[model samples]
Target chain A: MPKRRKCLPCLSGLALLAGALLVAPVSAAPKRVMSLNLCTDQLAMTLAGPDQLVSVSFLAREPGLSMLHEEARSYPANHGLAEEVFLENPDLVVTGTYSLHNTTALLKRLGFHVEEFSFAQTLETIPGEVRRMGALIGQEKRAQAIADDFTRELETIAAGQCGKDPTMIAYDQNGIASGRGTLADSVMQAAGFANLAADMGVIGVAPFPLEQVIAAHPDVISIGAPQKAPTLGEFVTRHPAIGALPDTRIGAFVPEASLSCGIPSVIEAVRALAALRTEIAPCHGNAAQ
Target chain B: MKLCMSLILLVFVLFVVSLLVGPAELRVEDSIAGLFAGGSEAAAIIMREIRLPRALLGLAIGMSLGLSGAVLQGFLRNPLAEPGVIGVSSMAALGAVLVFYSGLAGSSLYALPAGALIGALLAILVLLAIAARQGSTLTLILAGVALSSLAGALTALVLNLSPNPFASYEIIFWLLGSLKDRSMEHVALALPLMAAGWFLIALSARAIDALSLGEEAASSLGISMSLTRFLIVAGVALCVGAATAVTGTIGFIGLVIPHLIRPLTNRMPSSLLLPAGLGGAALLLAADIAARIVLPAGELNVGVLTALIGAPFFLWLVVRARREML
Candidate 1:
């Protein structure tokens, strides 16, 4: 009984020491950060300084989706799974709203700070999200600068195409569409084309009927492609109806990075759309002529 | 038996309730008046255009699956055998995907159902050929596993290859199954095929019962196993394939309903068929209602909810059955 009593204080002291060690690391900010979501990875790479970003989601390297694929290639890539995130001992982790909830919960429980970006449907909110992300990662100045550059680019693109009544459709994989209140909608509007999908009142990621597309008869069709394999040009050829649409111009808006992520990508997409309109000028001239 | 009847009644009540409720709620009197007198425009549109068709389609799909599942279980003498377990549902999904993504359905309204039925028929043919040669349920199951996996992989490959983002999303959601946004046109297309398939299966219930007494005994009783098998495959393919073509792959209803109702019918395959059909319709309707009401903001797929509930129940059943056998 006397020996047992003595062991109690020893065990208590050991537990206290272990608790202090666990608490010590959490108080200091994470030095090496990894982003597991495509959207967050874009922001992290953009604002967190190159050396601080240890890894990014593999999707960040896709040239079709990300505007920064070339820059993203320098960093290691993770597949957005929790196991992959843990291997790098990331001080800060970023994920998306649609990301696996259980995995995010598990990481938070393990004393890791995870910043989750919910699906931002509108363009107005994207700039705020960028600022929030900047504050989280200690890169508020870089974030604000990028945000300003994005708004300026958007205004320039919008100014150039102000008078044109260009009806546009964003043909994505599986006949799915970005309706009103989507980033794609802002991109379309910024590029000086009225989105046919917005007119149809599509709000989220839902399958739009092919019949609706056929009926809309948009002036230009922009097909979103994956970063790798079967480019938008190939996609257009595969669907004969899209290719054969009367007086319609087809274009590919490949941002190759942050283009689809938020505000910066939206600006990039607008520029791409403007370039597409210029390239298709002859087609429009021939139709009018 | 009494409990089964009450449950069936409850499902019927639920089906009626589903018919009456929607995104736009109407009073019971207005809905009833619309049903009979063709009165209020909103009421008529809701009753005739939306709810009636959805409810009926739900009923037909439920019955077809229930009947087909019961028949397959009885024939195989294994409760574990489901339509999906034997490659029918995946093949049906593949067929629907082919028609949907290939723009064949874009050309003609009939193309979707016809293409799906063809795909299902081809799969059934393959299953029949394998089952015949092996003459063992274990071998048949292995063949089914291979066929289902191949079909699923092929469907995924097709979706991936397709440039249409909506087509890919549709492939995922369709395989999961739902009845939302389904119109009267879908009902019109699926009903005739479902009716024909149901008739074929209903005709074979007695034959299925005869086969339970051993192949030789059934043969002596003037039932040809080959003919019976052909009829069942064709019937199941037509009904299930058509239903799936319209609604995507809805799992568990056919598998679960028969098992639930079998005991009430004294384990007689023939006796169990009709009740099983009723039970299936009720279960699907209830599930659909729950799906709508549970998350009013977001429409949940009926197949997903059923699978979520059914998978755990099925696991429990397997454990219980194993314990009894031991």
Candidate 2:
């Protein structure tokens, strides 16, 4: 009887230890996180809370591609140089696998806890990505809540999309357009528009003939926001040919740089374009706002 | 004059060819209707906006190179003295690079011609000073070679330093030229300056003919040396600068066209000017047509085509010169 009494105390102590280990994530989260990719910078910035993220990639400051460029200024920026990353001595590092292979590989060899995200971003990837990043930054519960809200909102927008699918092409710098398997293509599909470039057998960024674009005459021509700097390539976008398409609505329909990567911020682009599509080609009179 | 007239006709045909040929493959009827009748908006947009500017730029830029070639050869009295050979085009490219890539002009198209003119003017003044100090053909050519290399290097440096990531890719635009999608704005920017250059070159015609008799003999014939030099220098700078600002340094058009057509003309540098300009226009228009036709989708740089034709011809000239010297 005495032995059984002693066994109960020991068993309860073991259970208490296991419970403490289960809760370790909140206590054991890295204090300083560094993002070496622009896309990761967006996710980490949203989830890392104040004073948690130590630095972002230098590209985070660029207004053309970074959504949180202003917020990124408060943190130090890395140039993807190994020496710099090592010097920062971050508890964890994040980057994209598509680029900076050498730096990432080198950091891995030096025993740094590095995480790499793929560049093949799509609308479906954002919610899960937000949750994954949240777990990495020790904000899992907050991440799950944010992720669920995002999914609910995305579903709400998708539900409103009618059978009327307007064709659109994302004409970017130098007459290039996003084809199938691109973030822009995925965004187009989600926003109730068909990607004409992808339909034309374009698999990635490829030059589309001006004549082809004119002849096809999609309902909307989505374009990148013009950089303040001038280039001969920009001439393709501002061509009088594109402007003269009377029936087509052409503009920066997507928010600036939102479609650059697949992330929660891309929801802004999706929502804007969904609303515009509804305006230009309504499913029915009832669909009109 | 008859030869000049024929060259102009050829230039016209090539200009039309440049308009008709592109990735789009517009039918002849649609193209003509688009050009004049505005019957189809798509065709009209292509004809008026895309092709018109390219054709116009080809014509104007071609004329500038040919005219400058004739003038530089005559003024220097050196058979090898085309704009690229004497560093004017490359220097002007350097100038455009400085202003355009530096974002000094705030990425405005106007900055290209403005910077190019200044660069051309400086290059011409320096070359003229060198020629004045030593009229020997070898010294001037050697000096030109040095300046061109230096300018070329600096242009690459400036482009690499640009804030835009895409700016580095545009080094090809500076080194070898292309006029793929030149807009009317390009035409508006360069045509006036080129026209002014032609007028100045025309004024110095009689003086150049006299100088062919040798500098002293020409001067004794009541030709004011300083005035003639000024006209030719200013004229060449303005035309070549404006042309290069838009098209990049298109080599050999200035060099090969004049030499090829000079024999057919009266052989007097003054008499060769008009034919050379016409010939230059035809050659560039043809090359631009070929640039599109040859690759179709991956359009060959017009400068590359011109260089291909010009480089061999340049070699032949060098060989012939060496033999004559021996």
Candidate 3:
């Protein structure tokens, strides 16, 4: 009877362990996800299967400014405020470096699993962010596939049009231009136009003189269309010299979503640049003489 | 009349040149042809759609600022008085910024101007309340300075707090002021308010001329001090608030243009208003053209350029004013 009683307790313990094992995987997979930035909000929607996401940053739904306005409409959105995020009881929270510091700290204090992504201004850092995001969501294979696709797109665009002449410059409206080490510079390079800015030996954000733009006589001028400023076209056209550039094909290029804010957008940006190469090539060839 | 006709002709000539010259370099004949047969599709788009509206808006905004500045300075009886100095511009800017950042105006085009006008009106009322008690030029100037500084500080703080990186850049351009990319919408919104303001200011011009002899002398001359003050303040507020609502804060145009043209009209505030309006129009148009041409594919703010040119002239005027006082 004593031996039987001991055996019964052991069996109950085993059963409890088995029950926990069965429930663990189901609960571990994030059913309720919260995104704390516009970039992450966009990524979550793209990566997470439908009906899995709980909330996105309020910025995602701003049609005038958000690149993913249409997609963002489906999710209940938060302002990325700590109180708001915590109230939702999300299984996973995705935030960026720019997310409110106090909110992030408080979430960690409460033993919540919070993942943070870095803001990438350059192309090289994109893959790491992708892998990190993949590991967090248990979508490592999908993430790897997306990363591989990004690399392939960039490589293809680079191989096809990287050698084309009549160097171009990515002029950000408001007198800002991308120098070396910027994703814009990478895009310009992939589009078959040398970055005249790179020739100045300056990296990151540098002042490109309007006189230099004239002197460089770039074969093409590519303007970056920031989502916030829709009136950028008006501002750019107001400059008499931009209007006067001879044989220059001036077009605003929307960087792919992955390249713009995350790993996925980088590939999209490359594809967009590749498409622009055809338009730029003729202008470059004509300007060469 | 002859001078007015010549100024009108000069404005017409400037307007024509502005329409003709742009980044695209359309010839005069081509532009005219474009205006009529709509020339080539691109040229028509450029002339009718782009340059015409920009130049007209520039003309209207310049006229409003210039005329309003003249009235404010004349009423205050102080040459240092300008729209920005009196808090109208800063308030309008703050209003515009609030509308832009709050997401209230995010979906609507009209919200920005409407908010800006409301801000301007609020600022004007505040200034009037402060100035009414003392009814002295010194008190009015002090009140204006305090309000202007507060408004500027608030703008800076709001820009700093905004998560959008572009907000600071927008503030810089707003402070510097420009008529570039202005559309007919701005003109349509601003013109009636400015015209009404101008009529009110013109009526107060004789009163301003009377006040130059001293406020008591002006009152003795049958100009009720309270009525004159009310009309002038209201007029200046309406004109400047409307102008800044659309164009942002264009500095020094009011102070410099009025002073520059004051001598031509024998320093009579009543006579100076019209020519000052014309001269203001010419000066701003010229500045706008310079802003466009100074850099290839780059433009300077007309306000900055004007301030760079005006500040020195202002210093000289101050030194002269001080020397005369001494």
Candidate 4:
């Protein structure tokens, strides 16, 4: 029986190698693509041709975490398990540097073509990342167009900002504020608001004391949209102290999941913040100059 | 009398200190003005909405734990009996986690106490049944250990099961407890229920004092056994349940406070209650303050601080207990 099992695999291996040799000449780009990270899933969905993206990580469908969650429903989801990716047997896999290090390593050892996007993304890197994903999926022309549009739109917004930069903080659940070296910080800076948490020497996401928030009195406190399920942490964002800050615009300024990643759609966050900055402190003098 | 006065003074001082200490570094005069005279809207909100609730919860939850611990010890004649030690707090935490995270009651804060009360009621009933059966002190403690472990496991399981990714992070908060961001809403929801529980527990003070002279001796003095049991069980369920509902299971405060304060009193169960409660408030407030100071930005859990102090004291008691048994 062991001899028969060995012979069976040998026969199938020969057949698979023959099949690959026959199919390799037909196409230069991978036909089947799987994304093992949420950020990668959105990128793949945007750039991959019809039927090219076989599956995306399950987080891609989470409305609170994914900007393209509506479109994600069309694709099947993977839980980023090496077993799932192996079972599907995609030609190329894309993931992020943030999580699933073990799965990525395992898939690489199995001889799968894996592409990784760094988790440390900023507005400046979005165009490059978009272009890279496009090239990987053989949609470089379309990717270049989108990247140029993003850069042009961002420059227009930056031109509209006055020298008077209002202070803002991306305060999320549990009093966590987005600080320096984060995507939110870049977006806030581009939208003409000084990142208060970052200026206070906070690095990345950390607990910004409600007391400090009241003391600093930033012109805007951008909170995350409330999740479907309740958490005690959510209550911190709705703290009365935040509500009581004089002349501060406290609300969900950025659309849900817009600022969570450095996608092309992050322009929505910048646009929204820039418009808000124009409304609160107009750039008439800057325009004249 | 002096002990009672000193404890009250201690609690008051700690409450003031808890209010004053924070990451904001507000001056004393500004904080006072903010709390009272409405000086800057920002300062007023910080004082009234932020620090006030945290300080208030510390005092109330601490008082509830200490008072319950003293009452349970006196009624059961078991020095080791406490809400956290006896599994009631853990069960209450489990109940809160189940109801709140499961989305059964939506996103309302009311779900916490409602579920916790049910969990605490079941725990107290079970413990009461065992006590009624004349279970040994060791049996009660062992049962408590089993219940606590089971509830802790279930609490973790429920948190992990929640669809919200952030819910898993809350397992530590529910298990270890924190008073970091409590507001007046929490205080309002819990204070009245806790006060009612205190009143019921206070009503049984005389009965517990009588029970300490042995059950038969207490019955001879006209203390109804059934009435006393009902009061303690209901009171404990309300106090511990509501407290755990808001802050999770703050271990060792209920266990340690009564023991420490007992020495300051005349050794009578009824007399030990008030001072123990005051001492509990002082201890909890001090621990909460230390939690902020220890790691200013990402504060330590208040339960961690209490466990640090109480775990050692609990071991000392166990050793003494073993020596006495020998």
Best by DockQ: 4
- How well does model 1 score by local distance difference test? 0.73
lDDT of 2 by residue, B1-326 (tens): 78877887898889888889877778999999999997678888888988889999999999989989988888778888888888899999999988887777776889999999989999889988887456677777888899899999999888788776767777888889988767788888899999999999999999999988988999899999999988988899889999999889899888898899888988988999998898899999999989888975657889999999999998899899889989
Candidate 4 global TM-score: 0.94
Candidate 2 interface CA RMSD, Å: 1.9
If both were scored by TM-score, which would come out higher, candidate 2 or candidate 4? 4
TM-score for all models, in order of appearance? 0.58, 0.91, 0.64, 0.94
Better structure of 3 and 4 per lDDT: 4
lDDT, model 4, position B58: 98
Candidate with the larger TM-score of 1 and 3: 3
lDDT of each: 0.73, 0.86, 0.71, 0.90
Give per-residue CA lDDT, model 1, range B156-224, as digits (tens): 878777654434555566567888656667788899998999898888888989988977899999998
Which residue pairs overlap in candidate 4's backbone? none
Point out the worst 10-residue segment of candidate 1 chain A by lDDT. Answer: A228-237
Give per-residue CA lDDT, model 4, range B50-117, as digits (tens): 99999999999999999999999999989899999989999999999889988888889999999999
Evaluated at residue A143, the lDDT of candidate 3 is 74
DockQ of 2: 0.34
Error of 1 at A194 (Å): 15
Q: After superposition, how far is residue A64 of candidate 3 from its true place, in Å?
A: 10
Clashing pairs in 3: A242-B297, A257-A265, A258-A264, A258-A265, A258-A266, A259-A265, A259-A266
lDDT of 4 by residue, A1-289 (tens): 7999879989999999877744552346788999989999888887888999999988999999999999999999889999998899988889998889999999999998888999999999999999988877778788999999999999988877666789998998888998999999999999999999999999988889888998898999999887888888898898776876778999999888997788899999899998899898875753637
Q: Weakest 10 consecutive residues, lDDT, candidate 4 chain A?
A: A20-29
lDDT of 1 by residue, A44-114 (tens): 77777648888988878876566778778999888877788777778888888887788899998887777
